[model samples]
Target: MIKTNTIKSVGLKVPALTFGASGIGNLFHKLSNADAIGIAEGAIEMGWHAFDVAPHYGSSLAEIRLGLALRTLDRDEFVLSTKVGRLLMPRQESGLQNGEEFYDENPFNRVYDYSYDGIMRSYEDSIRRLGTRRIDILYVHDIGKYAHGDIPQEREYFKTLCNSGFKALEELKKSGHIKAYGIGANETEIMMEAMDYTDMDVVLLANRYNMLEPNRDEFFAKCEKRNVSVAAAAVFASGVLVKKNISEGHYEYGKVPKKVFARVVEISKVCDRHDVPIGAAAIQFPLRNKNVVSVVCGVTSIEQVRKNYEWAQWDIPECLWKELAEIGIK
Candidate 1:
């Protein structure tokens, strides 16, 4: 097994790589319970200590799976981060809240909720669901995008959550119930905006900084100055970086347009020049910077985890990076 390293940027020292649970929850497809647990456990055994899951993923089933896997590990060994904005509620059975009757469904089927009450409820519910004293990090998920309907009304919901969630998370940090507070979403602009409202220690950004485009320059500069660590996902661009014709919907992992594919083809040639696989280049590209401390790549199986972890071990030459830049990644 390859030993993992830690990035001591934020207040907490976390594994350089994390297992993003969105895919394992089978937002891609219904993953078997055993398979999810197996891959999650495999990540831990591989010396990875950071796990990122969100309620929006698999309709809250991702966290349930994470909690179940963590139950077997010594509590102090790992760092877990879950997002809010979409709260989880227990199924009501005969007027009684069905605590154990977990189902993966977002009640309103709404995009974002940041209400103060909703934020508190989300924190409380996550604690109950994970059966943990607290989460290491709680993010204001999808903080950038507004819901489709009711702009003013919907903004109020997110604002309430921001006001309540950040304060509550701060108190949780002080009380030792939470370790850190950050934002997690697929939006780059929103992550940068958090610097304005809150002094968070970490941010999880997906799709913004990947092999196709490295759009984190402004955020990277800010994080370096403030010591905020970034945990990136979707490095494969929803599995499009590796193969052509990726799927559509849910995180924009669809096939890179032929125009974009043109860039990747050139990138592949550059990686070929460097004598490395495109996969290896993709895995190592973001971490080349000092500001991006860790990357939480999504893994659907034990094999994918091993492949990613393996690629992470190899250091891509700076020459390859320069060559990639020449291919017009900008």
Candidate 2:
């Protein structure tokens, strides 16, 4: 079984690895209901019960599929988390067009809303779709410049969140509807700024503090000081660090850049020298930081689920880490 750690602020214990539900949402390809549920069941059989999903993923398809997979299990047997942004609205057209990253999604268009009503409605909607009574963690998804870009419009959204949406999160926590609340952002600076507005128990940080880019010590220190636990997402840097050939995988949800590809090549050489799998190192690197409580990985196939579990459990020599540090990978 994977080790568990308690996010002290929320008093919620989570597994070392949380199952990311994006793949089940039909990212890049379509998946049958049986296949999606099988992936979740496979993770449960391997002793991983924590899951994270978002309304933005397949326009709520992931939440529905995950709900079906956990319908039979006892509610207290697992940890559930989902984001509260981008409420799904009915699409005018009957045909489905491929989204930015998700494919064959439900016939719904996502509207970004970060107001008080938006947060509350998003929470209730997620509950209905997930078929759950309570959610352990609720995150304000993609609220920074990374998703919205640095512009006047982005500042307006941030203002709305600070002015109105935060109240809903606090109410949820106080009313016991949710155990904790935080922001899910890819940028650290925005999260730092958010801390000034409200108290956050945890942050689902993605695409940063990973093997390919592991220079976020200052950010982690700030999180520790604020008593905010971090759940690291995109630990594989969106698959670049895990693939045997760097060219085969993507980075930051897009094609791998030349500069990033070169860095991974050097890291791979160090891994080869120590006979350690690059995927294992990438998955384990975030846990080395004291404030990071869990690493989130999305898997589609049962084989990928088994492989991720095995990789998380793989042992690496201390010398490998030392060499990685020498090469600026740590």
Find the candidate with the highest TM-score and give its number: 2
Number of backbone collisions per candidate: 3, 0
- Tell me the lDDT of model 2 at 217: 72
For 1-330, candidate 2 gives per-residue lDDT tens digits of 788888978788998888999999988778888888888887888778899999888888999999988887899999999998788899998776457578878889888899999999999999999999999999999998999997998999999999999999999999999999899989998898999899999999999889877898778878888899999999988888877665686788888888888888888899999998898898898998878899999888888898889888898899999999998867
Q: Point out the worst 10-residue segment of candidate 1 by lDDT.
A: 96-105
Best prediction by lDDT? 2
lDDT by residue (1-330, candidate 1, tens digit) is 433444344357777777788866566465777888888888878776778887766666677787888887887887888887876544443432222222333332424557656766787877776777778888878766632244676466546755666777677677877777888877766666667777787887878888877766777887777767777788877777776442332336433476666666777778888898788888777777766767888887888888888887876787888878776553
Shift of residue 155 alpha carbon in model 2, Å: 0.7
Q: What's the TM for model 1? A: 0.85
Candidate 1 local Cα displacement, residue 30, angstroms: 1.6
Weakest lDDT window of 10 consecutive positions for candidate 2:
94-103
TM-scores for candidates 1 onward, in order: 0.85, 0.97
lDDT of 2 at 31: 88
